[model samples]
Structure formats: structure tokens, C-alpha cells
Target: MYAQCPDCLTVFSMDAETLAQARGHVVCGHCETEFDALASLSSQLPPEPFQQLPEHKSSGRPPQVESAVYRPRQESALAADSGTTPAAESEDFSHLVFSPRFARPAHQNRMRRWPWVLACLVLLLLLCAQLAWAKRDALVVDPTAGTLLRQACNSLGCRLPLVQDVQHLRLLARDVQAHPSVPGALLISATVRNDADFDQPWPVVVVTLSDVDGKHVAMRRLRPSEYLGDGFALQRGLPSGTSTALVLEVEDPGNKAVAFEFSFE
Candidate 1:
């Protein structure tokens, strides 16, 4: 009763008798192409010749009546009489034959999957970045980590962490001596050590030279650029559990320099 055009995919309804008379050949009204109607036929059975349905408006006149009559061959008749139908119509759908228009294109499916795969990769990278940010403080101290970060920061234009808790810097020794080369000038010497388990940035050392009465006579604040000499190798900061000697020559205040206080800022 129902058949489709293989080329244009247009559906039309006709009686079994009419289909049999036409031998499955019909003209499509939509595309005006003559093709074998049975090639695109659906599974719906034809209505009995005597069955009459209500009439409705149509786009075109009904198909012309055909002159010839179609009949089953002897073997087909024998199989039908034996209550067995042909397996072609009832075969496994997975192995069913498909026309060109009905089959899905493999490349289209592959193209559609790429965006989701790319999105998943982006999310994975973002997760890794969040994790790295969470552990930045701990990673900065590792010598190997510092090297890697420096290389990455150089290209990406990012700044490295350069300061830590100044309380970790301990004053090991301190002494002041007269500068032999320059009169009225005092040479200050101090030993500072890092006590933390990891490396940290150099802190500003504030030295206050005081008199016997404990009154501050001269004060000086040393910055990182002033303290880190050319001999220092570790670019990031000072290594943990290590000591560095600080030497400074400055003018002696008029009052006696009996005591000194060192504070790391």
C-alpha cells in the first residue's frame, strides 16, 4: 500500500492490485522521476482489493491503471502454500541492505565527536592548573621545581614568588670592627642562617647600631639587590639550613657603638 521513491524519498499509497498491475514501477509526482517503487517499499502490507476507504483531497490525480497483471511464480506459490514466507523481508535488521541516502556518513560522525574530545582535554588541563596553583608555595622551594618554573615564567611573562616569613632567618653571629683603610668608618659583620626545611627569598635585614644606653645611633636596611652578590648561584632564593655572611662598611655615628640589633623584615 505504501511505497517510497529511492531517489527523492517521497511516499505514496496504492492498492495491492494496482501495485501488482504496475509491476512495482511508478512515477513520483514530487520529482517526476520514473523508478522501481518496490526498491524503497516499506513493511506495510497492502489493503485488500475490496476494502474501500473515505476519500480525501489529494495533490494530484491517482496513478494511471496498468494493463498487465502480476502473479507469483510456481516456487513462490508452493512456499506460500506451505505456510512459509520468504526470509528476505524478515532477515536481521543489522544486516539489512541500505540505500545511499539512508546510510549515515562515517566522517560526519567522526567530526561531531571532536568538539567533545577537545572540551574534555581542556577541562583536564584546567584541573591540572588548579592543582598546581594550590601547591605553588611548596613547589617553589624545590630546586628542580624552581628551575622548571623559571623556564616557564620566562616565556609566559609571569613573576616568581620571592618573599617568605622573615622570622625563619636567624642571626648566628654579629660583630663590628674599625675599617683600617677608611678612618671614622665601621665595618659590620654578621652571619644569618635559614632554619626552614625549604628555600626562601632573602629578607631585608634591618641593623640598628646603638650606644651604651641602648639608644639607636645609626640605622640601615639592607635590600636583596644589595646583599645577593655575584657569587650566589641559586636564582630563586636562599637554600634552607644554610648561612651567608653579611659585610657592610658605613660611617660611624658620633656616639659610641656599644651594642647592635638585627631584625629581618
Candidate 2:
């Protein structure tokens, strides 16, 4: 078998029968180069059992060639004979014969994408939860509820137009009579201004009533016309000599109601 020196690129031949014996240290005839012939022919050679050669005694005659150095041209010629180029021969590659040590696992490849999918799912759920929470108090009114709301608004002192429908309403009532000389009644009203603005129809109103003794006397709903035009009318059936303070409140589907407050006397 023929081998090429990697460092000096010298070519040499070894006896086929003695190839295994001619391994590690061998003398090259052409360039008179010494090389690790076994390593140089690794691709074209197979492994052999470790064996030590008997030491050679020096010859009496002076050496014909003083230095045996391999050359690049000789290396190329040897590579061509071996059906390979010198560049191809010296490449540090073991992949042709052995697999890589660290190959990626199939599960690891799939797991790399999971975090993004999980995040998207979590974001979608959060969006749905937020939407539900935002609409939690959305009111769905029927004709009956609309009528009741209208009637309640009319019973208070606030004056408002006839309400068509109510979509949402929030009412807050409080009693504060500490400011005595002020009117004993508190009124609130709301209404829709135009048909184009009917999408959000319901309006909320708050009313507070208080008396000179820091007490609330009477509270009731008033009609839009009554509230806007004048103070709400007192309901009948009170004792003739008794005095009662009143507060009025009203909410109109349309924002056309007027809110006001005054003492019944």
C-alpha cells in the first residue's frame, strides 16, 4: 500500500504483507522522509494490533541521502494514485464513518415551539375574560322594565320626556339634611338627545333628600314634563296638619329630563 506524509507530503510504498509491520515509523525512499506511515494512510488502512519493531543497528557505510524531507508535489502524486486529492485527504472529518456525539432529540425540537403556543392560548383566554368582565353589568331591558323605569322617574320631581327603552341604569340615593336651609328635596333626570344617539339609551340618576333635623322625609319619582316645567306635585293622603319634605328623581331613555329639588311647603 502507498501512503502520503501529511506534514511534508512525501510518498512512499510499503510491502502489502508487511504493511501492518511498517506502521508508525517508516523510511520514505523517494524523498528519504521518515513519517508515521500508519497515521498517514488511516483512510486507506485498517487498524492493527500494537507491535514493536526490533531496533536497527547502524550500517557502516555513510547514508546516501543526509536528509529525507517530503515535498508537496510528491504528496499530490500519491493522493492522485489513491483516487483522492491532498486537500481531500487532510480534512479533519470522521462523519463519513461515525455519527456525531450530540444529535438533537425529536422531543426537544418539538418542545422549542411550545412556549409560543402556550403564550398565545393564555393571551386569548385573558382577552375573553376581560370582555366578559367589561360587559358584566350590561342591562337588557324589556318593554315592562322600560315602563316601570318611566313610571319611577315620573314619581320623582325630575321632569323628563317619555322613555322608549332602557339599556342600562344605575341609581344612588343618599340623605343629607345637615345643610338645613337648603331645599329638602334632591332630584336627578336623564334623557336621550336624538335618535342617532339611541344606541346607548339608558341614563343613570341619583337623588338625595334631607330635612332640617338631618332626616330624609319623602322620596319619589317625577315625570320629565313635571320636573322640567315645575317642582313635582305632592301625592295626596297626607295628614292636613303634617309637614313633609320631598326629594324627586327620574331617568329618561332620552337625555331630555330636568333635575330639580324643593320643599313640599
Q: What C-alpha RMSD separates each model from the true structure? A: 15.0, 22.8
Error of 1 at 74 (Å): 34
lDDT of 2 by residue, 1-265 (tens): 4466654565555443445455457766666777666554532333444233222345788668868554335777887799976764564432333223234457876788799999999999999868744543331123454445446656985422322333222222334222334343223322223221112322222242445554554444444334433323222222212232333333222222222232221
Q: Which runs of model 1 end up more than 4 angstroms from their true locations?
A: 1-111, 127-135, 138-163, 231-236
lDDT of 1 at 202: 77
Off by over 4 Å in 2: 1-104, 138-265
lDDT of 1 by residue, 1-265 (tens): 4676656766676545556678978888999988776655654534655232322335487778778655445656777889986555533434433334323578877788899999999999999989988888767656688668867887999767654867778889988888889999888888989887566787787879888888888898888677667545436677678998888777877657788888988
Best by lDDT: 1
Q: Quote model 1's TM-score.
A: 0.50
Model 1, position 201: C-alpha lDDT score: 80
TM-score of 2: 0.20
